[model samples]
Target: MSFASQAREEIARRSTVKACCVRAVCYGIACFAKYFDTKGLVLQTEQQHTAQYAQQMFACCGVEGTVVEKQRPSGILYEFSIREPEQVERMHALFGTTGNETSIQIDPALLRCRGCLSGYIGAAFLCSGTVTDPQKEYNLEFLTPRTNLARDFEALLAEHEFAPRRTRRRAVNVIYIKTSDQVEALLAFMGAEEAAAQIQRQKAVKSVRNRVNRHTNCETANLSKMAKANAQTLLAIRYLQQENALDSLPEPLRQAAAKRLEYPDLSLSALCGCFEPALSKSGLSNRMKKLEAAAAQLKQKREEACNEGDCTEQPAHRG
Candidate 1:
């Protein structure tokens, strides 16, 4: 039979059995109703407790986020990355305490994939834990074809606690454990709650590492480009300085040229290019040459002025 059909039949059988069993043991209908009401209240209380504990456990693992559902082809899954190496080690320690010999594998390789860890965790719960309530599930349809291991593990987990329910929506089944203390113990024993936080941290670290590497590479490339552009500009500026380019230039250009002359090897091209509307390389070259010619003329004029002054001041000399 198809899995859905089998599920339907199983559900029907269980319902009938439950109805009959309850009716047989009941002294009165009112008493049965009361019992069911109390059970529901207890279940709700446990769910709330579990949610709080899940939060605390996640916090203890140093994960400060809510548990999020991630969709996959085969089914929906819960996922968190380990950011702290210590949390990972703590998780490893939790799994180490379990004495049950199930095929629940937790290792460095498993750490990379949250789905894998979830599968193992679900399996471990199934093999050893009791399910007091039967409505919790982890959806299998979100998984890929033939990943029966995860699906089966989820089934076993549900069977141990409560009946699995199917919904039209494709999301990871959020099974609320009915027994809060048991859930806490399981978490403590398996180190799953902390491990969940650790997983979140690990993923965060990997993301950061990738970002840093990418930024570093980009910066390196940009720096190289800047250096090349600066080198060309500096070369032009030095040539102008050597040729005495400053005094011949217009006021603004002359000041810029003087500044370039002060650092003779500095790139005038870069300074010109940095302007709002960048100058063409040839424009920069022309401007520098003009400044050089002007500076040389000014220097010569100064020298002549000084000589004329000295000639005027000198006494008729010498015998």
Candidate 2:
């Protein structure tokens, strides 16, 4: 089953014994169902389990309904309709609706009982709510064709401290929550504890994976930069030695160069350990810079004096 279906099934199977909550559940089912009018009250779902649960709720409201099945391109649809003359009148009285209102809205009077909101919302969800898989994204929404009813639903969510946004899609009003925290919270609030926990677990796994990827990328970039820098330093050292300018460098510079030549692949930081006193990375870096500058100065001087004399060597390190 889809994740949303799992949540709906979870909601549908929960036990509610309180009279107020039971009435609220029936109201929620009526509010989001396909129709709730004098002719008949109808609730439909692709889930037979949910259809069965709705029939039970209809019975709780002093009404009787039968499940009707229909085949569609997607799957079989199970509809529970209360059309008997006596049952229809009881259904209307149970919900406090006359089928004459301007627009279908959640009656505040229905929620006068404490702890009834969650049961009501949960029932509404089994009818018109859907939640995406947490691994794919964090999204949960409730749909209704009536704009006023959508607004009322949005207000109800807000009163319970949930942050929701509303928009229209294909002539349907959508009340949605986009963040992980809210989505998880709503699922838990609606009594889908396992579904909510799964979302939490998926979120944690994704966070860890992203953090590890960033660290790995950062380390790779640093290694590439270090390799390029080591290559340039080694080139300068080899040219200085070829031109017979190594002996002119200071004793400390000579030591840094000698170690670098001995271990051509070692980075400056690693090379620090080869020294007797274990030079700091910054100290080794400075020495390497001076050596490169000295070599560059020598090369420039030789180029300028090449035509004047056989100036192929230097006795003093160039500044």
Candidate 3:
């Protein structure tokens, strides 16, 4: 199951204080339900768990509501409605709503107590919240159809120092937390400790995986550069051999060239270890540069000789 669903199920299984449950149920209905002139309310959701949780909360609050199931092309939908005037009035009082309007607004009184605040946020999430897999990304958002409700919810999150961001996607308004720490805090606030821990674990794993990939890529690039340098060194050594100049080189430079040709794949540092009294990397590098210079001298002489031969082969110009 998805993390969002898991979180909702966790919230549903936990026991909440009566006052908290009543406030939560009121918030859930106000945010999710369609109202008819203060006399009736209707809530439709695809999640059976949310519907069941709402029913339990209403029962605990001594409010009467009906649960109905409908089949749609997408899936089964659970519908909860409160038509009794008395029950509607009680909900309206708890949420400070007029019930005549469809827009949702948070009443400061409903969130005065910490428990009540937590419950209301949790219930609002059950209605329209979703979280992306932490393994892939950090994103947790509440989706609402009403722009004013989304703005109010953003303000509520800000009051708690959550610093949520708001955006509109088509007809839906999204209030989202993109930082992993904030998402974790939201889960904890909603009383889903296990889900919060799971997100932490996933983040740790992702960080480790990224670190490993970067290290491996660095090592591979270093190896490639070392191989290219070794190939160029061998080509220079070949030039010395063709010119019969290897024997005239200084002993250390000749040794460096021979060792490099013998083990073409070894790095300069590794090649230093193969020497009889283990030369330092700088010592071996200096010797190799001298050999390359000798090879370059031979190439220049050969080019000059070719140019001279071409001039001599041409007929003398008439005076």
Q: lDDT score of model 3?
A: 0.81
Top lDDT hit? 2
| Candidate 3 global Cα RMSD | 5.2
RMSD of 1: 20.9
lDDT of 1 by residue, 162-266 (tens): 343332224332333334344433333333444234334555776899999999999889777766755554565555556555344467566555455455444
Single out the weakest 10-residue window by summed lDDT for candidate 1: 38-47
TM-score, candidate 1, is 0.30
Candidate 2 error regions (>4 Å): 60-62, 98-102, 135-137, 244-255, 274-279, 286-290, 293-308, 312-319
TM-score of each: 0.30, 0.80, 0.76
Candidate 2 clashes between residue pairs 3 or more apart in a chain or in different chains? none
Instruction: Write out the backbone clash pairs for model 3.
Output: none
Q: Give the Cα error of residue 31 in candidate 1, in Å.
A: 36
Candidate 3 structure quality by residue, lDDT tens digits, 23-135: 66567556755442387667788888877778778777777788889999999999878888898887677566776665566667666577777888888888778888887
lDDT value, candidate 2, whole model:
0.89
Candidate 1's C-alpha runs over 4 A off are 1-191, 258-319
Tell me the whole-model lDDT of each prediction, alpha carbons only. Answer: 0.39, 0.89, 0.81
Among all windows of 10 consecutive residues in model 2, the one with the lowest summed lDDT is 310-319
